[model samples]
Target: MKNLIIIGARGFGREVYDLAKQCSGYNTEYIIKGFLDDKSDALDGFENYPEIISSVEEYKIEENDVFVCALGSIKWKIYYTELILSNGAKFMNLIHPSTILNTNAVVGVGLIVFMNSNISNDCIIGDFVTIQGYVGLGHDTRIDKWSHLSAYSFTGGFVVLEEKVLLNTRATILPHVTVRKGATVGASSLVIKNVKEGTTVFGIPAKILNF
Candidate 1:
């Protein structure tokens, strides 16, 4: 089994551990090497099992070891992923067993696909991305690195979600729509056109709001 290290000890990190444990296939394939977190307080309860490993600088990566960033925020996820990669650690994509991916889809490393999510044919999911529960990506869609798709979100065919984009719960993107980097689509919004970078859109039809 390959050694697997998870970054971030709280929040999403804890969720990843739960998911990994629940998914028998992932646990059997990799030995969890504990987590890396700056918050030493978070390590108190988890000291026994999984064996929490501290600093990123202190981590010694072997040839058979792989790392996963369990951070929820897109920026920190990308930052720490790069840090681990620079230290010769390979990133592993964690996909829940309940999720479905088409044969023609391409998913990059370090992605987190939560339970009940679906990636349709010809879709491309980039590295270090987090796709939450019940999200659906239509055929020919492209989701860039560090993007977050919240629960129950839907993206139609040929849609492009740029890096660091956040699609909130139940948001719907029409076919051929483009959501630029760092843009945020609020809950239950409908996206039909291209969204500008670093902007926040809300309500039906997704009107731009001051981010």
Candidate 2:
């Protein structure tokens, strides 16, 4: 069995640890080894967590090691994962057993799907995309690489989320809406239209934030 190493050790990483236990092939297929974090004290107060193996820069790729990113920040998620990928590190997809993934859906590598997320028919999820707990995606929704859907986020049919886009907690995107690359939909926001690249939208109708 391969050893799975989680890249972050904070809140999201800790939560991923719990989710990993419920994955389909926990002990038989792969076993969790430890966490990789820059800060040594990231799990200082946490009980019953795997130890931080080393700083990201200090970790040497091992033969039995596979990785997964649990960082919440989109920028850091991309940067650190890419850094590890540069070293030819292999990654594993972590999908909670309770998630509903359609057989017609196409998923890329290094995906993290939390429990109860429903991925509908023909949904295309790109590399390293994260779907947090209770997220619901409608039919033909497309999410590009490194995008993050926070807890309780929902998207209607044909919604397109471009690379690195972040949908905060409870954000909802209407049918046929497109959120462009690097855009952020704030918590509890409703998106009824296309969002521009690199902008942040918030409020009931998700107006672009001025500052």
Candidate 3:
């Protein structure tokens, strides 16, 4: 059986643990080993979870070991994931059993999709993407690498989320809208037009936020 190691031991790491338990073949095909974090006491207050084994930098990859990243920061997620990749570590996609994924969708490696999320037909989810609970991805949607869709976020058909885009809770993207790379959509915002790269947009119509 393969041993799974979760990267990071913070809030999102704990949540990923809960999701992993509910995934298919929890203990049959693979079992969780422990967390990999620099902070040794990252899981000190947590109960029933395996302690942090070793930091990602120090941990040696075993023959039957696989990894999944649970870090919340997109920048750090990329950094740590790439670091582990350089060490010849393999990653597993942690998809919740309750998630609705269409058969026609194309998904890359290391995707973390939470429960109750719906990915419609013909969608493409890139590597290391995170889709939070209750997020709705419409048909033909394309979400690039390192993009994060927060809880309750919804997108209409043909929406494109470029690399490193962040959609906060309850954000809605209209049909055919393209959120450029490194853009942030605020919570409860409605995106009608294309969001510029590296900008933050908020409000009802989702105008650019300057600060």
Candidate 4:
């Protein structure tokens, strides 16, 4: 079993640590080797495990070490992922044991699928994507790299979320709706139409916001 190191050392990082334990509960495949945070100050604490190690930037990569970028932002996801990859650090997909990934779904590396998230058949989940708990992706959905689906978000079949898109909590995308790159669907918004790149929408039948 490889030793796991979770990057980003914040709330999401700790969450990933707990989720990794859940993955091991059903199948003991990896042993957690504490966390490697970006800030040296973040090494000050952790509710579980003893090792704080060092900031990911200065830490030396080892052959036995595997990483999971627990960063919540797409920009950081790409940045940190590239940082680790360039340094010869390998990443592993951390899918919770309770999550349901269909047989026909295609998931890229460094993906994080939390508990209760369901990826239906024919879906394509890109690299470094974060599917939060209670999220559901219908069949044929395509989630591009560094995108995030927050808890309770639901997407209909054939929906597409481009790179760095954010589907906030409980957001619903109707069938065939495409959320372009870097857009955000506000919490509880109902997206019946396509969302343009870099726009932020909110409310029922989501409308683009000025902010």
Candidate 5:
């Protein structure tokens, strides 16, 4: 079993830690190795689990030590992921035992999928994407690299989420609606139309509030 290091030490990091524990018994492939954070503030409540390491910039890379970015921000994920990759660190993909991916779905490397999430038939998930628990991706949907779909978010069939797009918690995308790169859909919003690049949408019909 490979030693797993989870980046960031907050809520998502704790969740990822638990998920990794579950993955161990599910597949017997990884051993949890605590967390990596810049400070000890986030490690306060997690006292039982010692702060085993620091950021990728300072930590020495072990032969079999692998990592996963447990951050919610796609931008931060990209920044740290690039740093770690450039430092010769290998990343690991974490898929919960309860998650379901259709046979026709094509997933890329370094994916982090949480419990009860479903990737439907013909869906293409790109590298380093994070799908929070209970996310539902319909058939033929394409989520480009470094994107995130928060918990309870729903995507209809043929939907396209470009790279770095973020679908906030419980957001719903109508069928065939395409969200462009770096765009964000606000929590609980209903996207009835296509979203342009780098825009942020909110409210019932998901109006573009910022660009």
Candidate 6:
């Protein structure tokens, strides 16, 4: 059985562990070696079979071991994923059994898809992307590298979110809209138009909040 390690031990990390357990091909025979978290000593009484390996810098990566970032934030996920990849650690893509991914969808490496997420036909999700629970991505939507789709967020058909974009919980992007790199959409905002790079938008019809 191959050994797997989780990089974060927080809420998202724990959730990833549970989801991995349901993937019979990976977890039924694979061994969950442990987790690597800075706060490992602080999380008492946690019942998953992962012991804290070490801090990110202290842990050693073996070629045979698989690692999952399990981070919800785009910044952290990208940073850690790059660090791990640079160190020659293998990154694993985790998709929950409850999530529905269309046959034509193309998912890149190091992605995490949580429960009840629906990815429609021809969608393209890039590396290190995180899709939280209850999110619905419409057909042909393109999510670039390191982007995060928070819980309950919705994207219309052909919407494009560039690298490092963050869509907060319940946010909605209309069809053909483009969110540029490093842009953030505030919770529940309705994105109807193109968002400039590095900007933050909020409210209905998503006006630019941080220029």
State each model's CA lDDT, in order: 0.86, 0.95, 0.95, 0.88, 0.89, 0.87
| Candidate number that wins on TM-score, 1 or 3 | 3
Residue lDDT tens for model 2, 1-211: 9999999999999999988888988999999999999999999878999999998889999999999999999899999999999999999999998899896999999999999999999999999999999999999999999999999999999999999999999999999999999999999999999999999999998999988
The TM-score obtained by model 1 is: 0.93
Query: Residue 179 of candidate 2: its Cα lDDT?
Result: 99
Report the lDDT tens digits of candidate 1 across residue range 4-115: 7889888788888877666655658887878888775785655445656886767777778888888888888888888878877888778888899997999998888889
Candidate 3 runs further than 4 Å off: none
Give lDDT: candidate 5, residue 127. 95
Q: Which ten-residue region of model 2 has the weakest summed lDDT? A: 16-25
lDDT of 6 by residue, 80-101 (tens): 7778778888877778788998
116-167 per-residue lDDT for model 5 (tens digits): 9999999999999999999999999999999999999999999999999999
Residue pairs in collision within model 5:
none
Identify the superior model by lDDT, candidate 2 or candidate 5: 2
Instruction: Assess every candidate by TM-score.
Output: 0.93, 0.98, 0.98, 0.94, 0.95, 0.93
Q: How much lDDT does candidate 4 score?
A: 0.88
Supply the global lDDT for candidate 6.
0.87
Candidate 4 wrongly placed segments (more than 4 Å): 25-27, 43-46
Candidates ranked, most accurate by lDDT first: 2, 3, 5, 4, 6, 1
When superposed on Cα atoms, how far off is each prediction in RMSD?
1.8, 0.7, 0.7, 1.6, 1.6, 1.7
* Candidate 4 backbone overlaps, count: 0
Model 5 scores worst on lDDT over the 10 consecutive residues at 23-32
The candidate 4 region of ten consecutive residues with least summed lDDT is 43-52
